[model samples]
Each structure stands twice: as structure tokens, then as C-alpha cells.
Target: MNIPEYLTSGILESYVLGAVSDEERREVECLSSIYPEIRQELDRLSAALEDYALSYSALPPIGLKEQIMAKLDFGTEAPPVETETPVVALPADSGPTYKITWIAAASLGLLVLIFSFFLLSQLRQAQRISATLRDSNETLQTEIQRQRDIRQRSEDLLAMLRQPEVRIIRLKGNDKAPTGEMMVYWHPHSRQVMVEIMNMPPLPANQQYQLWSLVNGQPVDAGVFDVTDAPQKMGRVIAQADAFAVTIEKRGGSPAPTLSSLVMMTPVTS
Candidate 1:
């Protein structure tokens, strides 16, 4: 808007030399379109610089000029390009605009290439991680199946120990109970034992069910169990048991079954 300050800013020099950047050139173009004074100053400065360049131009050697003029006159075809910048044909040099556009386009293309490469690499990595997780899930499933098979076999062996072919002994609850009863599972082939108690009263905290094997009419301690609604069987039970009896003994059972405290008596069928 101010002619003096705009002229003093050296933009006129840059425009005349075609050295202005694209952004600067666009700004100058807008100012020239809107303000007549800025355009007047640019034209005046450009003419002065053009005249100074022409002032340094010297005449060609005498006959060389005549020979060039004679050839120009004789040729009827198009004239050849004589200079890099043709002052009469162009108002401002357009070469730099093409160069800047090419640079910007190449920069955009390189950025797109890099972004596509990065996205593709991430996709491949994600696929690999998913595959690894899938393999881990498969391994866990296989291990679970194996553990289930082992547990099923153990349950089958326990069921066989309670089979009817194995001997059984029924014991009726005595003074401690009026109508309660208990049963023992005995296998002569394996010499393993399990016991089940039904309708028995709860034992005192420090007391438990003690099973005794009667050998030669003397009580040999089989082991101890805790009977509630369900049966509680001792582990690795039979040594050499003939008949079985029950008593209320202290926890962990006495070394021998207490005679006076006997509850039920039942002989082994085998």
C-alpha cells in the first residue's frame, strides 16, 4: 500500500532478476493487481535495469554483422533462439515457476512412498504376532486334553475298588446311634479298602472315627477316618484285616482301637 517502503524493500530488484520465490512472486502479483502504484514502481525499476545491461553490449566486428544480416534476409524459415532471456517476448521469466513445482511434486511423492512402506511393515508384524498367539492356544488345548485323560484313568481305578466282586462289611451304629450304619469296601485281590458311613452323628472336634481289624479276637488299628453325611476313607488302608469295628477315638486315632468305646461290628464277607 505504501510505495516508498515497498520499493525500498528490494522486492523490485528480486522481481527484475527473476530471483523472487514462488510465494513472494504470488504476493507481488496480487499487490500489482490491486495497487497501481506498486506496478508503476516495478515497471520503472525493470526498465532501468534492462537499459543498464544493454549499455554494456558492444557492436560486433564490422563484416560479421553484415554477414549475419545477409543470412537473416536470405532465410525464409523460422528464426533461431539467440539468448536465454528474450526481453521483447516475455514480461517476466517463467522458468523458475516450473522448477519449484517439480521440486514440490518430488517431495510429495517421496513422502507417500515412505508412508506406504511403514504401513506395510506394521501389517506384517501384526500378522506374525497373531500367528504366535494362535500356536500358543493350540499347545494349551493339547495339554488340557492330556490332563483330562490322566484324571479319567485315576477315577476309573477308584471305581473298580468299590465293585461288588470286592468284599463288603456292614456295621450298625451302637449306643452312640440308634439307627445309623456304615459300610466298608474291601478288595482281596488288591488288598485295598474304602469306607462309607451313612446317617452317623457328627463327631466332637478332637474325636474321629477309628476302624479296627479284629485278628485273633484282638483289635488291630486299621486307621482313622472322619465320617459326616458322606464317607471318609483312609489312604493305603489294608495290611492284614479279617473283620472291622468302629470306635470314637482322638484325632489321628489311638495305636489300638479302644475296646470300651466300640460303636459297630461287621465281619468281612471274604
Candidate 2:
């Protein structure tokens, strides 16, 4: 239920005035226990009533006790009454004490309300920042994985080239491009070959570089690949070749190397 609204309604005032029905008094009592604000309001009303009572509090008029005693004559010769010490009752608490207590409680409630709102705002902002950081962390993890794969491939290629059985073949450019150069790492025993574009000229958009292995004087298509900062492992050469060459052909590469587009070639040494 909307406790604040119910507290603000006239029910509390009626409860304070002792004018509410029994059902309403029970409801108020129940709510007061359930809601601190309701309880605080109830205390405030009680404090106000105490203050009102204190405002009109005074000593009884002088000699009024004698008038009450004279009215009750002791049958014109009743036995003499025994005298005893009269005791006066004092209130356990003063009006101002209740007032101070209520004021302190109300102030505390206000402070609690303000602090709660500030804390809630901070929590929401923290959640937003956390979400953003989580997304960034995921993106960074993906990029790190991609780099790791690249590094692993580079390592594998280096390990292959370092094998004692592998032969390094340098292919020099022909008259079409004198400065273009490339290298091939070939393991004759395993027929494994890795291609590295050292200083090859950039090809047109619709063309790509293709490797060819010459076996028995016939050109065999090795594979087609792009030039990157790292060496690329091409398809394994199925047969021992006497020479290897590079040519620029259509993007997907031709089934046969175009002799006219040949850029560089190197004959196997051993």
C-alpha cells in the first residue's frame, strides 16, 4: 500500500483526536508498526497533544479541597478521621522532552531519505559503467585471440623454414619487373613449401599472385595467395619440382600459370 499517502491522509489526525472507529484505530496501529514514517507521524501527533496539555496545565484553585470536605459532613459528630501524609504524583516526562525526541526522529528520517536517494543514483551509474567495461573486455579478448592465431601461424612457418632438410630458394624478377623478388622454403623430402613475398610489386585489383612448381618441365599450380607482412604456407607440392615461379593472374588464379605474366623464377639447387 502507499504508506506515505495513507500517513498524509486525515486518518492519522482522526486517530490522534481519538475520533476514529475501532477498525480504523486497529489499522493505524498496524500500519504504524509496519511503516516507520507512520510511526513517526504518530509520535509527532502525540507530542503535539502533550504540548497542548502542558500549555493549559496549572495548580488547582486554593482552598477547593476544603469545599469538597465540607460538603461531606461526618453526621454532626462522626468519629475523628486519622491524618496521614498526602503524596503527590509527578509526570515521568516533560512536554519539551517529547518535543525534542520527535524533532530528532523527523530530522533523522529526512537525512536517511536523502542518503538513500544519493546511494541509489550512484549504484545505477556504477552498473552502467560496469556494463560498458564488460563489453570492452569482450572486444579486447576477441582481438587478443585473433593476434594469438596470427602469431602461432608465424611461429609454425618459421619452424618449418629452420629445418635442416629445407632449401631456401630466392626467385629474382625478370625484365617485366626487375626489382620484384620472392622466396620459397621447400622441403624436398616432405614436399612442403612455404612462400614469402619479399619485394613483389603490387598487382591490379582483379589480379593476385600465384605460385607454380615446375615438375618434369610442366608447370604445376601450387596455390594462390595474397602478400602480407608474414609468410604464408601454400598447398604441399605433391611431386619433386625442378623450378618454382610466381605469376600475377586473375584473383582466383588460373589452372595453369600464364607464362606471359610470369614475374620471377628460381631453379632448384639440389
* Candidate 2 per-residue C-alpha lDDT over 35-148 given as tens digits, one digit per residue, 9 for 90 to 100: 899999899977865665554444445664555545544434334446744544443332332344445555555455445445654666687688889999999999898788
Runs in model 2 lying further than 4 Å from the true structure: 1-146
Q: How accurate locally is residue 14 in candidate 2, as Cα lDDT from 0 to 100?
A: 65
lDDT leader: 2
Estimated TM-score per prediction?
Answer: 0.40, 0.47
Q: Which residue segments of model 1 deviate by more than 4 Å? A: 1-158, 161-164
In model 1, what is the error at residue 254, expressed in angstroms?
Answer: 0.3
Query: Where is the poorest 10-residue window by lDDT in model 1?
Result: 89-98
Expressed as tens digits, the lDDT of each residue in 90-193 for candidate 1 is: 22222333344445555555455445445554666677688889999999999898677556645654685657667777889877676768877777666676
